[model samples]
Structure formats: C-alpha cells, structure tokens
Target chain A: LAKTTQPISMDSYEGQEVNITCSHNNIATNDYITWYQQFPSQGPRFIIQGYKTKVTNEVASLFIPADRKSSTLSLPRVSLSDTAVYYCLVGETSSGGSYIPTFGRGTSLIVHP
Target chain B: DTAVSQTPKYLVTQMGNDKSIKCEQNLGHDTMYWYKQDSKKFLKIMFSYNNKELIINETVPNRFSPKSPDKAHLNLHINSLELGDSAVYFCASSPPTSGNTIYFGEGSWLTVV
Candidate 1:
C-alpha cells in the first residue's frame, strides 16, 4: 500500500473554503486518491476520490495534478458541522487482486463559527 | 434502513474477559472489514474478508479474532482483553471492485476496565 501524508490539523472559519492536501510521492501506477471525513462519535464517510485531474461531488471536490504525487480536498462554504478528521488514502490496485488501503492520522479540520 | 449495523453499541468489560462485536451489512457487499480507532483517533485496519474468505490481516494481536459467516456479516471476538483494547471498533463493507468507497457502521465503543 502507498503511504500518505497530510496535515495534522487545520482551522477554518464558517463560510470559508478549506483545502486539505495529501502527499503520496510513491503512489503506484494504479493508485487512486480517496478522502474520507470522520466526525467525533460517528464512522468515517467517503467524501471524494480521484485518479487524476479533478473530481467533484455534492460534498467536496478533489484536485489531482498531473504528477499524481499529491491531491487536495476542497470543501466550500464550510460550516461548523463540517469540522471533522479527513483521511487521505491511496488505493493500490494490483493485477486482478484485492488490496486494502491503509489509513494514516488524518487531517483534523476545525470549522469555527 | 441502516446499511451497516453493529450490535451492542457500547460494551464495558473487565480485563481478561472475552467479548464479541457483531456486524451486519445490508448493502449486498461482498467484502467486509474490521477497524480499530484509538483514543488519539487514528483508524487502523485490523482484518478484512471477501466472500467468506480472509483477505487482509494486519498486524493485529492474536487475541483479536475475526469470523465471517457469510459475505454480509463479520464478527470480531477478543479474548483476554487488556486495557489497551479499550477503543472504538468499526465494521465496514464495500463492493469488491469499489474498494475506495467503503461504508462504515456506527462503531462499537469497548471499554476494558
């Protein structure tokens, strides 16, 4: 599995845009970058995923540059409820095999009102 | 309906006791996983099973045993639990190919006194 690096913590005010970046310099060829959001007492929820370029959903947007060495998750107009730990994972897909993606200490985003 | 459901949302037991956390997913997924989240809120994968077969087994303790009766259910049994075992255990499931977007159940908080 490819290891990922992200900020330990970030702070953002309500109605502001927050971007959390993750670096995976040794990302594999078939690796896809995915992000998950975890609240205090709840399970982690899938936020966004991308292989390259940009992928947007109703909740967040994922931007991956051409190098694919890093990706960023952008949350627009954040609210206090959006404060959660965001995990960045790089999925390693081998030739017709199952692989489990590893999770690191995610970026804890604190959205303050 | 809850896609993934775990029984006994909170469990408190003394050290050297044995306990099990039952999990069931109604999403018709073929793969399920067990993860442990520590007090510092770092999520770690313990084990994974696909179609009733063990696939991913991390460096978890031998006291932690996972059993999958079928694809939709995975139960974790911990024997002779210790104080360090007091943490939130989460059950998750996902499609075989869509490994990036895993659905996690509300965790089972275990307190080993």
Candidate 2:
C-alpha cells in the first residue's frame, strides 16, 4: 500500500478556499487518490477522488498531477461546519484481491468564523 | 434510505465483555470494511470483506472478528474488550465500479469502561 503524507492541521476562515495536499511518492500504477471528510462524532464521508488531473463534485474538487505522486483536495467557501479531519488515502489491491483502505493520520482543518 | 447504516450508534460496555456492531448497506455494494478511529484521531483499517469473504485482514488482534453474512451486511464482533477497544468504529462500503470511493456509516462509538 502507498503511504501518504499531509499536514497535521490547517486553519482557515469562513468563506475562504481551503486546499489540503497529500504526498505519496511510492504510489502504484493502479493506485487512486481519494479524500474523505470526518466530523466530530460522525463517520468519515467521501469528498472527492481522482486518478489524475481534476475531478469536481458539488462538495469539493480533486486535483492530481501527471506523476500521480501527489493530490490535492480543494474545498471552496469554507464554513464552520467544514472544520473536520480530512483523510487522504491511496487505494491498492490486497493479496486477497480486494481493495484495501488504510487510512493514515489526516489533516485536521479548522474553519474559523 | 441510508447507503450505509450501523446499529447501536453508541455502545458503553465493561471490559472483558463481548459486543457486536451490525452494519448494512443498501447501495448494493459488493465490498464492506470496518475501521477503528482512536482518540488520537487516526483511522485504521481493521478488516475488509468482498462478497461475503474475508479479504484484507490487517494487523488487528484476533479479538476483533468481522463477519459478513451476505453481500450487504458486515458485522464486527469484539471479544474480551479492553480499554484500548474504546473508540469509534466505522462501517463502510464501496461499489464494484470503483475501488477507491467508499460510503461510510454514522459510526458506533464504543466506550469500554
């Protein structure tokens, strides 16, 4: 499995754009970078994912470079509710032929008023 | 309808006891997973099941057993629960079409006292 590195924490104000970057230098060929948002006392929710380039959804956007070694999740117009831990995961196949999701330490984003 | 749902959203059990967290997904996904989030806020993959078969079993202890009775249900049973077992356990599922995208349940907060 590919290991990802990201900021431990980030602080932003409401209505601002927040970008969280993740680095996975040893990403495999079939690896796909995905991001998830987790709120306090709740489960993590899927925010966005992309193989390469950019993929946008109503909640967030994902940008991956050509190398696929790194990816970024961009959340526009941040609000206090956006304050949560954001996880960056690189998916890979396991020996049992199932996709294993190993979540590492994520970036905790704190949106201020 | 909830894409992924977990029962007993909060569980407060005594140590040396056994408990189970039940999960169900209506998304018709073929894969399900169980993850543990400790107080430090690190989410770790405990197990994964594909089509009712155990696939990815992480370094978790044998006390943590994941059972998949069908394609849409994955239940986690923890035996002789210790204080370390007190954390948030999340259940997730992903469709066959995407290996990286997953939907998560509200989570089961287990407090071992």
Candidate 3:
C-alpha cells in the first residue's frame, strides 16, 4: 500500500478545466493510480485510472509521470454537477489477485456557475 | 439496474443496539469491500472479501463484523453500536485483478442516537 497526498480543496468554474494532483512518493513498481469521484448522496464513481504516462476515458484523463511518484486527474469542461470530492488511490495486486486500495482525505472540487 | 446496491439507505439506531447493512453486487465481481466515511469525510477501508474469503481486515473493532455469503453478497453487522459509529458505510466491489475499476453502492447512512 502506498500513501497519497492531495490538495484539500479546489475551485473551478463551469466550462473550465480542473486538474487535481496526487503525490505518492512510495509508489510500488506494480502499483497503479486510480481516481474516483463522489457526489453528495451517491457512491464514488470511477473517473480514470493509469499505470504510467497517460490514460483517458469518457469522463476524465489520468496523467502519471515517468517517475510514477505523482499523478494528475484532469476533468474538462466542468459543470456544477461535477462538484464533488475526488479520491486518488494507489495499490498493487496481491497474491490472491485482489487489490485493496487505500483512500485518503480526497480533494473537494467545487464547480461554480 | 444498479450494479451495486445496499439495503437500508438510512439507519437510525440507539446505543448498544445491533444493526446490519446488506449489500449485493450484480457486476459479477469477485471482490467486495466495506468502507467507512466519517463525519469529517475521510474514507477508510474496513474489510475486503474475495470469493467469500476474508482478504483484508483493517484495525477496525471486532464489533464491526463482515460476512460474505457468496461472491456477490457482503453484509456488515455492527454490535453494540456507539455514537462514534455514526457515519456513512459504503459497499463496493471490483474485479479480481489489480488496477480494475471498483463500483460502489449508495452509502448506508447510520446515525447512532
């Protein structure tokens, strides 16, 4: 398990791009970084995940540097509905083929009008 | 058709009482997890079960017991609930491999009165 550090909160306006960075200095060789988004009364939804370099999905893009010590989650053209808490997790596959990701305090992104 | 669902969306119980939150995932995932989100909104992994076997158990108290009857069902039972136990409990499931996306259920809000 790797510990991750991220900003406590961020502010973004609608139609703007929002980027939240996470630092995982002790990331393992086999670890993968994943980002999740949680709304007020709903469960956290998977946004994007990447092992290295970059990976993009319909919702967001994840950028991991070559060193793998940090990663960034980019959400484009944000809307008020995108205002939520974002979590970054780093975990590796265990022998049983299961990964128990550790969650941090997460970054609260407020998308304003 | 929600992939993951938990019963009793909100539970209001008294101290020393016992309560249970049932969860089922129809995503055909092999691993299920229980996570706790405190009032301060810090999410922590409580337990993880893979194919009905306990895979990860954090330092949570014994009063919080998790039972996985099968690959698709995991239930949490809390005994002698205390005020400190008031928080949102989320049920989630993921594939057996690492770096896969995990689906979460709408949390079960437990209020210990």
Candidate 4:
C-alpha cells in the first residue's frame, strides 16, 4: 500500500472551485488513486479516481500527472454543503486483495456560502 | 432507498459490554469492508470480505470480529469494548475489481462510556 499526504484543511467560498492535491511519492505500479468525501455524521462518498491523466465525472474531476506520484481532486462551484473531509486512497480493490488501504488524516474542506 | 445501510446509526454503550453492528448492501457487490474513523477523523480499514471470505484483515484487535453470513450482509461484533473503541464505524462495498466506485453506509457512531 502506498502512503498518501494531503493538506490538513482548506477553505473555499461558494461558487468557487476547490482543488485538493495528494502526494504519493512511492506509488506502486498497479496502484490506483481514489478520492472520497464525507460530511459530518455521514459516510464518505466517492468523488473521483484516476490512474493517469484526467478523469471527470458528474461530481468531480481527477487529474494525474505522468509520473503518477500525485493526484488532484477538483470540486467545481462549491457550496456550504460541500464542507467536509476528503480522503485520498491508493490501493487495489480485488477479491483476493491482501494489503488494506491506509486512510491518513484527510483534508477538511470548509465551503462557506 | 440507500444502497449501503447499517443498523443502529448511533450506539452508546458502557465499556466491557458487547455490541454488534449490522450492514447490508443492495448494490449487488461481491466485496464488503469495515472501516473505523477515529476522533481525529483518520479512517482505517479494519476488515474486508469478498464472497463470504475474509480477504483483508488489518492490525485491528481480536475483539473486533467480522461476520459475513452471505454476500449482501456483513456484521461486526465487538467484545469487551473499551473506550478506545469509540469512533464512527462505516460499512462499504465495492465490486470485485479495482478502479470502480465503493459505496458507503451512513455510519454507526459508537460511544463507549
């Protein structure tokens, strides 16, 4: 399992774009990066994921560089409801997977309306 | 309807007691996981079960036992709970492959008094 590091906290105003970057200096060859969002008293929700380049969905966009050493999660037009802690995970999801994912201290994004 | 659901969203119990948290996923996924979020908001993987078989078990205490009766249900039974067991327990499920989205439940807040 690859270790990930991210900002402890971030602040953004409503309608603004927020980007949280995660650094995994020792990412494995088969490792895929995933991002999750969690509101207070709720479970984490999948935001976006990418191996390399850019992957966009209806919720967020993930950008990965050629080296795959880091990834960015971009949330567009943020609202107060988007204020939550976001986690960055790197691992392989499989039926016979061995190593478990280590979720370090996540980035808390405070979106003020 | 919620795809991943856990019973007893909030559990307040005394130390040395035993309790169980039940999780059910309607998403038809083959892999399920239990994660614990500490007071500092660091999420850690406790266990992962796929097709009723244990695939990943982290360095969690033996007091924390995971039982999966079938593909859709996974229950966590904690024996002799201690104050350190107080945290948010989240149940999640994913497909058998990586890069796919993992759905999470609302979470069960366990308060050990």
Residues A15-96 of candidate 2: C-alpha lDDT, one tens digit per residue: 9999999998888787678898888888888888788999999999999999998998999999999999999988666776
* C-alpha lDDT of all candidate models, in order: 0.89, 0.89, 0.91, 0.89
Docking model 2 quality class: medium
Error of 4 at B39 (Å): 1.0
Interface RMSD of each: 2.2, 1.8, 1.8, 2.4
Q: What is the alpha-carbon RMSD of candidate 2 to the true structure?
A: 1.5
Number of clashes in model 2? 0
Q: Which stretches of candidate 2 lie over 4 Å from their true place?
A: B97-100
For candidate 3, the per-residue lDDT at A94 reads 47
Model 1 residue B23 lDDT score: 99
User: What are the runs in model 3 whose C-alpha is more than 4 Å off?
Assistant: A92-98
Predicted candidate 4 versus true structure: per-residue lDDT over A77-109, tens digit per residue: 998888999999887343544645556479999
* lDDT ranking from best candidate downward: 3, 4, 1, 2
The superposed Cα distance between candidate 2 and the true structure at residue B57, in angstroms, equals 0.7
Clashing pairs in 2: none
- Kindly report the docking quality category of candidate 3: medium
lDDT agreement of model 1 with the native = 0.89
User: Model 2 — TM-score against the truth?
Assistant: 0.94
Can you write out model 3's per-residue Cα lDDT over A1-113, one digit (the tens) per residue? Answer: 57889999999999999999999998888878889999998889888889999999889998999999999999999999999999998874446555668876899999999
